[model samples]
Target: MAKIKVLILDNDTTSRDILNKSLEESKDIEVVGIAFNEKIALDKMRLLNPDAVIFGNNFNDLSASLFTKKLLEAYPGKGVIIITDSNSKNQASDTIEALGHGAFDVVLRPDPNISDIEKIKFIERNLSSKIRCFSIKKFSRMARLLTPIEETQPYNGNFKPSCVKKYENSKFEIVLIGVSTGGPEVLTNLIPEIPKNFPIPILIVMHMPKIFTKPMSDSINRVSKIKFKEAEDNEVLKTGTGYLAPGGIHLIIRRNLKGELYVLFEDTPPVNSCKPAVDVLFKSAVGIVREKAISVVLTGMGSDGTEGVRALKENNVPCIVQDKESSVVWGMPGSVAEAGLADEILPLNMIAKRLTDLVMK
Candidate 1:
């Protein structure tokens, strides 16, 4: 396989050198160029046409946000990953804004207190993995596939019922979504389409870092009519709101003595190599919501949610999978489909509407 070409952008010479050295250490990645500012980065991007760009926090004299927006608009298909220092003020908000504007992912710079060897190792591990994932052709294809709901099929409000007879008579109390890889983009498009008055609480498990989940929820909340936020331990589950499983932790629902539902965060080891594994949440919901749960497996890179969907299916819960053509990577949803677990396999645009109809009606 050809090496993934990358361009580094940073105003700090030390930072640029660290990233350049760390990234090139991987045989699968090649550092095509390094730029100290927006102008230089744009020129390098135009000349080198690297597969992805590692954008440092400082953009010399230009505005970082403006630079990111222009870079994406100018290059169109190239991926941009943002790097932020741990001590930066409002780093979460900044990272979220960058993601909303089109940056593929965000990685934090190692704390200055760490040893040089540790920092280099951390940078190499994180940056190289992101570069490789972003360079995949499927991601680029999904980016092109994203379009406004109006442009796709109209919402007919006609949805087929679940295959299991138990679900036909049961009322859906919660909506669970499992997504990864292209999740942020998919959520940005799907969440805002859900109306504020829609019934049932929604829980989402999107594979992301500890620092990114809150910001991801905030970004979705800003555009969405229904409230969206990171799930908090012991917080009561409510209708007309969406909860995102915090990154690096497992989110599960539990009932208190009063029979009211609340959120629980687990520090258990990762399942299927995912901390907030979909199976963890789905399995928990199986005991709480039972046949009334509605499960969705969206675009992702692996089969993390397949077992969870199967568990839900065995209990007669309704499962929805994003169709193959609309996904960045069809691993998760495809797994559920192949298992004959999904009740509906629909495109991204129709998901929110179908979900609303199921819960609200």
Candidate 2:
């Protein structure tokens, strides 16, 4: 794996130096450089090309937000963490704006007190535990709580119910979904309400850390009528069960001699800053199911699913994207919708019905 390169931008020489020193000792993170102000950060952004940035939210300007836009424009894939003291309201405003500009997440500056220092110590020492917990929580649920998609087709055999929207035969036999960032929330709303005996099975990819998927799967199963579980490698995608890609791995589908599709997960390096990258699964499924597949791109934080949607469209598979207002981050689904790659764009409230209707002939 390549190093997670990081750059720090803080006017406080003391704090900047301290953080630089701390992360320099990290095995997973590489401290590439540090800057005392926004201008220097921008200059080094192009020069250093770090994978992540830790910016101090204290800007010299009082009325205007800092270089959040410049940073986003310079490096679209770079992750960011804002460190701000509690003293400045502008700090929070800038942080939110930074997220709006495509920062990954935020963190608070730890107090200098011994207790807070001890907490940092605990976290630093338990880094493995934190990563593990997030991974396990990704797909632990077996049911979901949701409302039937309101504006689209219901699970019942309704509408034209044709693959081409004009035929009598239902064109969709497989439900393949791709998501990230806010995927857990999306699943909690859609999976539970899908009625049983719906015939088709669901295959999903939610970009997440390891140990987080199982808990999510368990939670979904308890609330929804259908069963949900993390996809076990080589497990068959069956009816009434929704398969989620395991965290820290790529979940793919392959066909046997009899044309049976089996779900599989592999521990490969992240394809797009995500282990369970939606693109990996979605692209694979397009070849496996072709015109019989119904692909849905849900709320997420990147363009990971966009290319996959393109692949689906090229192969005659019908794909949909979640509409903008319903998306939390709006990056993944938005790109596909904008590219005219998806056949339909609906809100979360209407997605299930649209999907179900596609499946009913």
User: Quick one: best TM-score, which candidate?
Assistant: 1
lDDT of each: 0.82, 0.67
- Clash counts per candidate, in order, are 0, 36
For model 1, residues 67-156, the per-residue Cα lDDT tens digits are 668887887777888888655546666766767767777788887788867878989987787777777643456654468777877766
**True lDDT of residue 263, candidate 1:** 85
TM-score of 2: 0.59
* Top-lDDT candidate index: 1
Q: What is the TM-score of each candidate against the true structure?
A: 0.89, 0.59
**lDDT by residue (tens digit), candidate 2, 255-344:** 888778898777778887778888888888777788788888987766898888788777777777887666656688888878877667
lDDT of 1 at 1: 90
The C-alpha RMSD in Å for every predicted model, in order, reads: 2.7, 13.6
